[model samples]
Target chain A: MIKNVYDDEVPKVVTIKETVIETPTVKTFIFPFEITEDIHPGQFVMVWDLNNEKPMTISVIDKKNNLMGITVRKAGPFTENMYENMGVGDKIGIRGPYGHGYELSGYKKVLAVGGGSGIASLAPLLSFYDNVDLISAASTKDELVFVEKFKKENIQVHECTDDGSYGFKGFSTELADELLKTGDYDIIVGCGPEIMSYKLLELSQKYDIDCQLALDRYMKCGLGICGQCCIDDTGYRVCVEGPVFDKEQLGQLSEFGKYRRDAAGSIVEY
Target chain B: MLKSNILGMNLKNPLFLAAGILGTTASSMKMVARAGAGGIVTKSFSLEANDGYENPTIVKIEGGVINSVGLASPGVEAKKEELIELEDIRDETPVIASIYGDSEDVFCEVAQRTKDYVDAFELNVSCPHAKCGFGSNIGEDPEMTYNIVSSVKDSIKDVPIIVKLTPNVTDITEIAKASQEAGADALTLINSVGPGLRIDYQTGKPILNNVLGGIAGPMIKPIALKCVYNTYKTVDIPIFGVGGIKDYKDVLEFMYAGASLLQIGTSIMYDGPEIFKNITDDLSIFLEENGYNNVTEIIGLSHEL
Candidate 1:
């Protein structure tokens, strides 16, 4: 029998923490650790937005001054609740910096491609790898996030929208394809819509550029023990072993770009 | 000064943290040491890299938990960093490395690789919820159990080895004796029970990602005690009893049932990391009040009846 690693007690709140919203549906949450600790860019926190029954993975936009910032997109019930109810100085339970993260060494030039809310998870990496070229996409011009945030760093911001309201009237894929054609980047890191990542990974592979994709699988316990966020492959778990997996590894899984599974391994497509 | 032993390596205290739950890293292991645990065993790592199962692998059941963690690990090579770091912690706490493998060769290889870092070794032959060809399959059979344990014993000459057993077997005593004869130094009995499943009535489906899981915590205490009780009658080697033990009373029951030392597992999940301090403090009180000078006096006290 598999042993259960149980830690269910929710820590009581002493003070509420807050993050400023960059867009109407997108906001960043700042968590100052009670204990002094170091967190990396790719490692995520299991944010238990009290209104929901389970925890959700919010991106760590930055970890400095002993505080970790999570960027969230209001898409589902959990995010909606978090957007409406959560504010600065409102406390919520946060556990983890769990799972393997992007190997931030050996690469010279890198590109970060994010779609919609996916840009939040990649912001920290951009800060870490200052040389990164960031391409962000949304459905419309108003939806474009982090434009000012990236401008502060003087990094190149390539924006794309479906309705041609922004810099490019296409998707991040078109921008990424143009960048890949330059043959200057050593690595391509992406997170966002599955199709966007899938297209970027394919393009990277064609150019023989190393690519890493962070997948958003359903999770319960952020620990590897919970099998809720398993990528369908031989011995792959997104929560523990990853949220970040190699593009080659992602290519091997059949359900890489489609629906996800619940606790029972039942696939539910979005 | 706190002389005790498991497998064969002399331990200062019998209170080693069980595998998987809290043994993932050196910091966590160091935290366990600081919390007053005598020793620490690492979460089981496999020879090859395994992502194991996905999230929601564990869930709460009444009195305990039903979990199908699928033995997620960072693979052996990556885990060496954590093992090496344990040497730096300023404690004489003997580190026991718990490892799992599909075959005898893998066990032997990992033993050889990790032998220098740890004081002793635990071949996890009894993970109840492991997939076929891994955990319980090797543990349930006398010959297979013997092979896995003996192979490690042959490879690691200096360190003592403990073959952990699962209670799911119909006759655990036979497997215990087989491990002893095959060169096992001691035995750690009862590595969780039941590839049990809990279904959520509201969802009309199972709660865990893997529908079936191993049951631990208070629910398996009686069965684990029974396994230790039955094995005592057949094996002469000292037993390291573990299962559903939450306090000094539970530890005492194992000692009376024939366990020389005890391991605390699932309770740490329910009670928090302070469980080690709680158990030891309670034990100190229980020992002084019971007119017992030392813990050894109570081993197999139940057999006197």
Candidate 2:
């Protein structure tokens, strides 16, 4: 695939154009971005809000409007700061669109699944391609991100929430497994919890279907020099080689579903 | 002819990925090894876990970056897994563990734990921004430098010791000589040059969480060359040059200044890991064209002149 590589370590100041409350826990912050690099879905940027910096996947890529958006889940200190003080007209810095994005061509049918805020990375795929369906999962109905927008786009939406407060009760992989039984798909795209991706990977292997999974790990230098985001086994930097990996690539990672390193590089099993 | 065997490690070339940038994991170190680095230096770790600084640990300036990662280490226990992974590639690429401590006891303890995996240990006594007397506090003093070097060098079995010295001192050669006397196998000339600070014009505040960070990149090359050149003349051991090496030309200058082994850091921040292959390939082309037999012939050319 002809992927766009937009990576600059120097932080570029950008004004916040708007912010959308996707859910109670998630928000999509829109900003005016010069689309110089031919970027695609699943590529992320390091967002610097003056006080702190964190990696956020590009959720909205509106080329015509010259605008971009990042959907953030307010889970940690960085996100908490954004929710409390950041808004329209507030200036922030972005330095990448780092790592390889999902490859969209040469596939007839695709099943894209996202859990909670993980759907943000897959949101752009809906607009980038055709004949692709989505499995949007979260803990509760209010927690499902980008569902209304996906519904507006008239694409197939399979909603699954763990609390049975939304669509299919239980895990997103369970819903995906049932869907695989019901229909045949060329590729299954997953982004969310590592456990869900692991289960989906097993399902893909079981049904003999190809898959792509996006990974989110503790990273320091989103530029790939820190080695904080490097996965075990292949030693591939998640910042460069992936945040998204195919079924074959995902299989090479021993730490994919089992465990990951904390901020201090200590092993923490999932 | 770019290959060299130094201090028990067979190097495929004279180029290595410096510590603190991308040396956090075994997988990452292996990635660098596959990318064509002669050796790999794991990021500095200690006896206990340290969170380091908060956000804004690194920032870019004109010539290079000012970073105070605060020597964030996962501790010896956690980092041992990464060091152990390096054993698989010990033949093709030797692994160097860059370690730090507030005293000689912690230094020996950390090396003792992970000594089995790494081929050598690069003492990180030169980090200008490390807090609580952990880094430069010991390096600046000749006695402390000798004490730590001797303590760790004496305790670790079969592993060579390379002392990384800071240029932010009255005379680096004194520390270099002390390290050599204390049984250091080699010396790494000049860690980051400054405890520099960058204040954002927009916010009127410091860019780094620690307020001050070490300076690295092309800006510190001349100083690094001076240190390498001076130390090479004083000490009997070899020198590892590390400061703002961006391209083959930079590596060439470092070797000429008396650095037998070279490390590439800060530049790898913006440039990809491919920098290793690019620099090595270009160095090879330069060597072939210049009619030099190998990389070893060029060491200390400036000093001879």
Candidate 3:
């Protein structure tokens, strides 16, 4: 048997830190793990209360802040517990700075795109670079929370909303695709809904925009052992090899931007 | 402590890491050893290279993982390089080469090629997730299981042969008896259960591309223990128990169920390589506290009643 380092147990707590609630569905829980002294952008930490099964993917927003936080959506049992029960002073279990992050260098101008809760994963990538353009879309203005953070960093911000309650009247993919076709970018980095990321990749491929996507999947074991968070066909375990992959590579995976499974191996409809 | 001989090979402890979880590479096998495992078993490799299944080969159900790795391997020749690397790290820690194939010749050839590098050979004729031509088709039939095991036994020398059996049978003892009748040395009871699959709710698609996978981890622990307990009544050879063993307590249960040794597979994924050390340390304490003289005394202890 191959030796797996991280298993399904709770990891030792490094530190319980805090961040402000930028919005109701998106509050950043800051945790500083002494175990992870050196973590890079695009790497994420799994956070969930011991009483719950839902794991939050907290992006390493500020490695220097000693306060890496995850922005969560009130979706299910785990998140509900995290939201209703968790506090700024409460300590929760954290495992990983796991998964592959975005490829950032060797580009003249790049675009970082996000949708809703997906913005939490892109924060570090945007914070690490100053020359990049930050394009984001949400359901409404109230859902648009990270604009000030992007503006504070002096990163170009393109905001869009579905109901015209914010910036553009359409989706972020539309705005991203238009700018992508100008042949002005070397790479486009994205994370959010699968359809959104998939659409971004589709446009990038059509317009020949080099792109990388931060994938999201359920990870029961932070190490590659559990096989719960496997991506399609590549036989690549997201917890060990990557949560990031090139768009050209993404096209080859059979279950990219997909959901969880039922007993019969069929995709469960939401 | 359980200081016992499996197939005439000495094991400091009877606890081993089972095949397939992290056994694909030499590094992974070495890591399990460093974590206090007495032995290692490589992922099931075949004579030819197989890609296995795509991502989501494993999925989390309530109690275990459903894996359909498709027996992904780099084939025999490439696997030899990994076995050679294992030779450098060779110590009292035994690395059991687990091999599977479509025919008896294929099994013998693989056994012959790596016999010198490994401490023992585990014939994987019972992988539940393997396709139509693979896995249990050859294993379920007593005659075929006996023939394939006999072929490898006839070809390979020195290294003891262990046949890993599937639990998806009506009478596992019959299979064990047949394998022993064909000259098998030792047996590893239970691979995964079911050609199981998981589905994605939103996309209305199967979670794994292969559609069906082997059920492993904690989910099948009860069934595996039953198989070991039942097989012990019929077979005299040592049995290596594998299923969902999370700690030393689980290992003890396997021993009570008639397993001379136990292996940790899916548990490694959840707990990391430290599981070996963690369980060993805990077992030492349990042994001392419980006033047990040795681990061997517990083997089939429950059957005495």
Candidate 4:
């Protein structure tokens, strides 16, 4: 079985078996990984390309086919490189299904909110969670991810767009606000920009529903060894204690939605 | 009781969160302090922000890791902002700013800018992988070590000064003695050992972006012990022993080898930040079993043998 990956082993090289264009800027690369029972949603893996190593969330985990996927949004030099150059049959080194993934057990109904590329992080949960209402929101209809994939699973999807070209025309938070007034969701899970997660946190509190957020920060050494992604106030390592944190846990982080450190550890106002 | 006094800071125990790992930020350092480390030594920073190397700057090997983080820092000015947040925790869990530079002037400048926020300065002149003659280049030579330490000591006085030495030198004691004579309050024996390599069989390329990086973790413990042991015999200053320390047994060996205190790095990757409390708890039990009242009593006991 593929157990919890530690840094002790060299990154396992896997060839891309399939590739799908999820959006105008987003693409999903599929590969056959053996015994991926250890990987979980919200947890990320360090993808080693020809040039460098970066952390990407596990988007698709198919146990039966033993296939895994990473949905990449073309952002920055590394991902832009992946968009322009990386393709099927290309060998990429992958280590870990690392860090804390979302814990959605015990809850009956889950209201999942994914903004833009963040749907990639929430996709693994859609397979595990039976009762899920996903609000897939984006700048435009073409920028949305994983809507059809969720529909194929009979998962209810609420499509949201900013320009009114889709079903629900508004911010994901606005659509989620309307849903919360009627939907009896026990838990509200969010993955997106810190601003979107922040709004989701507020909505969860407004409805008194439990909330979990998958946050993004500068990450290196997907293992907790490097303090690159550590958060404020509590000093919790985002690489270990989180990538996923509950509403109460999010309350401890003062830097959330306000700022985050760069590669130089200098604060950049968001 | 694990309470001890060394380097003028009243520490609850002898264990410190070593520099170079998890010492990157104020929040992270605060996390280690809360995890029960007696002191926090920050990752080395300098006058200008350094991006370090590209991707794959670190890789896992047999016993530990080879890291080429390239001394990535936000410069002393930006780093001072992080350190300012640490100042509140300084009285309880003392913060040690680990600073490095290309020359003595930069070293002293960094120490001067940060002396207010930190309880001590760990001069990381021994980082084996840093480029541009910054890390071990200055630490390997006794005269250069003296120049930096003395210059830093001259610029600052209230805070303790620590020179973290590299083991790749001909005789570590020469550098240790130079640090002591130059007014360093203490010494930290050994940064990571060799600028080692781990080549990918598929691509035939080194795993680290820098190709070579310093080796750290369990394999280097004995080497660290010996460095601390030999330097202990030559210098009067207390030594902060670090290298592949995983548990309480390693802690005891370091104390016996003449380290008055300890720092745990690298192994924090294997275990979590909880390594501090785990080792300290086991150490307390070990001390109780041995009829020791204070951990200080065990320091340098191996010397008499």
Best by TM-score: 4
Which window of 10 residues has the lowest lDDT sum in candidate 2 chain B? B200-209
Query: What stretches of model 4 exceed 4 Å from their correct place?
Result: A1-7, A151-155
Worst 10 residues of 4 chain A by lDDT: A1-10
Could you report the Cα RMSD, in angstroms, for every candidate shown? 12.8, 2.9, 12.7, 2.1
Q: Write the per-residue lDDT of candidate 1 for residues A94-136, one digit (tens) a residue.
A: 5566666677588888888889978877777765666777788
Candidate 2 C-alpha lDDT tens digits along A161-191: 9899988999898889899898879789988
Per-candidate clashes come to: 14, 2, 32, 1
Cα lDDT listed for each candidate: 0.74, 0.86, 0.75, 0.87
TM-score of chain A of 3: 0.87
Tens-digit lDDT string for candidate 3 (A1-270): 323322433233433566556667766666765434456666766563533333455555555555677777777766766766677767665556676777777888888888887877777766567667877789998888577766775666788998999888889998887777674888888888888988888877787768888777655445577444555444456666667788767876667755533221223332
What's the true lDDT of residue B294 in model 2? 88
| Prediction 2: B-chain TM-score | 0.98
Ranking under DockQ, best-scoring first?
4, 2, 3, 1
lDDT (tens digit, per residue) of candidate 3 on B1-305: 76777676778888787887666656557656777888988877877777565444554555667777677776787778768878865677888999998899889988888888898999998998887867887778899999998888889868899999999888889999999999999999899888776554433455555677888887799999999999999989889999989888888899999999898887765666788888888888898898988878888988997
lDDT winner among the candidates?
4
When just chain B is superposed on the true chain B, each candidate scores a TM-score of: 0.96, 0.98, 0.97, 0.98
Highest DockQ: give the candidate number. 4
